[model samples]
Target: MRGHLPNAARIIDGFHVVKHANEAVDKASKAEAGENPPLKRTKYLWPGNESNLTDPRPEVRRDPAKRRSKTARACGMRERLQDIHADSANRTEAEAGSKALRSWMMHSRPEPMKALAGQFRRHRQDILAYFDRPYTNAILEGLNSIIQHAKTRSRGFRNMDHSGTMIYLTCGELGLNTVTA
Candidate 1:
């Protein structure tokens, strides 16, 4: 989305959100010349919601326009990346806004699914950012892929919250929110 919908105010990727965080972390491994830290290691690397997350992901989390080492000029679509930063450098405030979302969920008094909740918050921007932009795309087709995949890979919902979270998170990824995803 950072590439395809850079100008778009709100580009909701209900399906891509989940993969991006993990991808960020994965991408960080190859970025050695940048200031942004790589994907977070360990589940609880970030402290409770206070402010100023020391987690390495923050630097990796900043907007591309903010990247100090960005050397990409007004180039055409990039198919492959040279460094881990290629993701962050091309990212938007919406995609970068996951820091706040993750913070909110991590500190939830009753901590829903700290892990998955963090995942949702981490990608909140990419999911909700669609509303900010003029163009709104459909992601339900992709979300269906997740639902079908989940059902085949795992058993039925263990609990309603987990089930709801899975559905909501998937909706956010697929850009489908029947009930305010």
Candidate 2:
């Protein structure tokens, strides 16, 4: 991509990165739940809501079981990484915070999270570039979704031109004011 667009700013969408981190946490949690019955059915509790969590009590803090659980640890690390995005005021700060998170993940017990950390390390610049550019392909994705919906409605267009026309009619901003006779 850089080779084709030499001047374009390469950025990894923060949304997808966080989503991948959540997936890693989910995988860890599922595996942990198989061994620890208490962790079962708590899948939804971590992936999305973990970031909103407040500090744990000092007593829970002292519990080795809670601290040693791979899922718990992964969720904690994922939450911490999300905090970097929420709290960092500038690119430098975001980068620093992400580096710290990456280091933490590298040493963490969860294999999935360790792999995710490696991905973050490999795409460090592209991921951190998001702090500077703050751009995502959301609009393009929305348009693609709309087009897909149009295609599904048609089932199968007879020709390429028909498909293109359908997409244009569905997605184009055509101002069709009523014409009186």
Candidate 3:
């Protein structure tokens, strides 16, 4: 498709990009948790919003005396990545944000985070496309979820025709009220 549509803008979904960073944090947290009994039940710490840390669920909240660990540092990095998206106003800003994030992740100790950074570096152009036009696949993904649910409820369709019709009925904004009964 890229070959045929050479002029088309390539946009990567922001959600998927953030998901990768979150996964890296999760991996680090899991590894740290294995050796540290205190972190055993702290899996929720990395995935939750930074604001949650101040008023977190009883299980995940950090004690005042306990110093922040490498997992916490990884979580902080994830927050920084999210902030880059939220704060950037244009492509130039996004480029700077991406550079900062890449540099930080490159030096990060977590292997997963370093791998994610490498991915960002390789796909830098697609990732930066978000700033050029703030578009996401969220709507399509939502509609897909609805279609999948309908398919599951019906125990799967026997043919693509049935599936396609179901998708259109559920997702297509057809003005049925204007049609005659």
Expressed as tens digits, the lDDT of each residue in 7-90 for candidate 2 is: 898788778888999999989988888888656666766665533445664344336675578887898888788788778878
The lDDT per prediction is 0.40, 0.80, 0.79
lDDT, residue 163, model 2: 75
lDDT of 2 at 168: 76
List candidate 3 stretches off by more than 4 Å.
2-4, 53-67, 155-164, 173-181
Error (Å) of candidate 1 at residue 178 is 37
Error of 2 at 24 (Å): 0.2
Question: In terms of TM-score, which candidate is strongest?
Answer: 2
Candidate order by decreasing TM-score: 2, 3, 1
Residue ranges of candidate 2 with Cα displaced over 4 Å: 1-4, 50-68, 173-181
Candidate 3 on 1-181: residue-level lDDT in tens? 8899888887985788899889998998888887767677778766877575555453354553222666877777888888888888888998998898889889977778888899999999998998888898888789889888767765566887777665666667556564355
- Candidates 1 and 2 compared by TM-score, better number: 2
lDDT of the structure predicted as candidate 1: 0.40
For model 2, what is the C-alpha lDDT against the true structure? 0.80
lDDT of 3 at 100: 88
